[model samples]
Target: MATNQEEVKLFGVVGSAFVHGVQIALKLKGIEYEFVEEDLANKSDLLLKFNPVYKKVPVFVHNEKPISESNVILEYIDETWKQNPILPSDPYQKALVRFWSKFIQDKIVASFSKAVRAFNDEKEREKNIAEASEALKILENELKEKFFGGEEIGCVDIAAVFVAFTIPLIQEVAGFEFFTAGKFPKLYKWSKEFLNHSIVKEIVPAREPTLVYFKARYELLVSASK
Candidate 1:
């Protein structure tokens, strides 16, 4: 439980998967924190002050200290709250988890974003899709249990919030299909299981509005690409 002396708050925008990861971590640790929804078009001075380097949302402020980046915040939350441990206690297992989490962040998420952004160019989109699918295949081969964290949802699972939720929504809006069940059964199944988890169910943004928002962005991106 969080003490009254320790103040916690999250600065973020709605419909952001990165921000959602932080929310899930805090909830998993049963820490009560204030959520400050930032208007990215006109970012708040507080958010700017907290995360000047990146100037991004999902700036986690704890005890008047701010931690930027979603993955970093998740690690901080796990280290700060002893209960409901997300990272493994063993050093080797912990390193494996961190390795996979970084893989998801760097390869999986980046490849998917490239695919979405390459929507207007068929050849480019196909190339990006191939790269994205290849990344998913690596994760598919790595899964031997219910999650990347084995039996429980761990840091790697939380790190893959974009994979379970956001990427599917992006696929829908972008009219693409790279992460299908037939293509990557293990990863696809893991996504379904991850999304169905109780905490994930609560934290995931409502599908309808999220879709609407992404659809609008998709249109704008396509138009710009043209």
Candidate 2:
């Protein structure tokens, strides 16, 4: 697809959080791009060639340059296209946004991955649950007054939306629930508001379907473990 300026392509899958992050960033920036869905179970040569190190999805190819890692691609998108800027212009605010963005990518995304599926050690699972809760609590507190950084849905908010959605799927698979009303009120409210937005609602897949998919996979994994 032409952006009336240059061709942009994003390689990723719909169910992936990282991929969703980049997609939302691009949409919010009003950037046009072609989205290529990869079958991660059967990765294509192009994906391997583009991201040899991580061989992960959510790789953004801009002007023939391949950028991997969702957060890195987000930064690249902000810098490359100055329209509808996601990060704050102020240095301190930018730092805060980046910090929470990294926190979500690390604690919520990476750490929760292990916590949900293929958890062999009971102790390890407990540790992961604790850590994940800590991260969620921090996010909840940060989102107490506003919808993320301020009144708008910015970089950190974008990341949080995916985290809130996918994390529940992870929790359901692991027989856990973190977004209880009493426990994470702010985050729960934010999640509701974020998912309700026209942009997010239009782009995202239905929650029940995602839950069913993950539950089946989780059941299979649990059976295999036993």
C-alpha RMSD (angstroms) for model 2: 2.0
TM-score of 1: 0.96
TM-score of each: 0.96, 0.91
Across 1-226, the per-residue lDDT of candidate 2 in tens digits comes to 2367687999998777778878888887888889989998899998999899999988999877899988789888988889878888899988988899999878866667777764678787777777877888887778755668577678888877666578767686687765566787778878888877777776677888888887887888888888
Give the CA lDDT, 0 to 100, for residue 106 in model 2: 83
* Predicted structure 1: clash tally: 0
**Tens digits of per-residue lDDT for model 1 on 1-226?**
8898989999998889889988988888899999999999899999999999999989999998999988889888999999999999999998888888889888889878887887557888788788878888888898899988788888988988898889889998888777788988888899999988899889888889999998997898789878
* Quality of model 2 by C-alpha lDDT: 0.80
List of clashing residue pairs for candidate 2: none
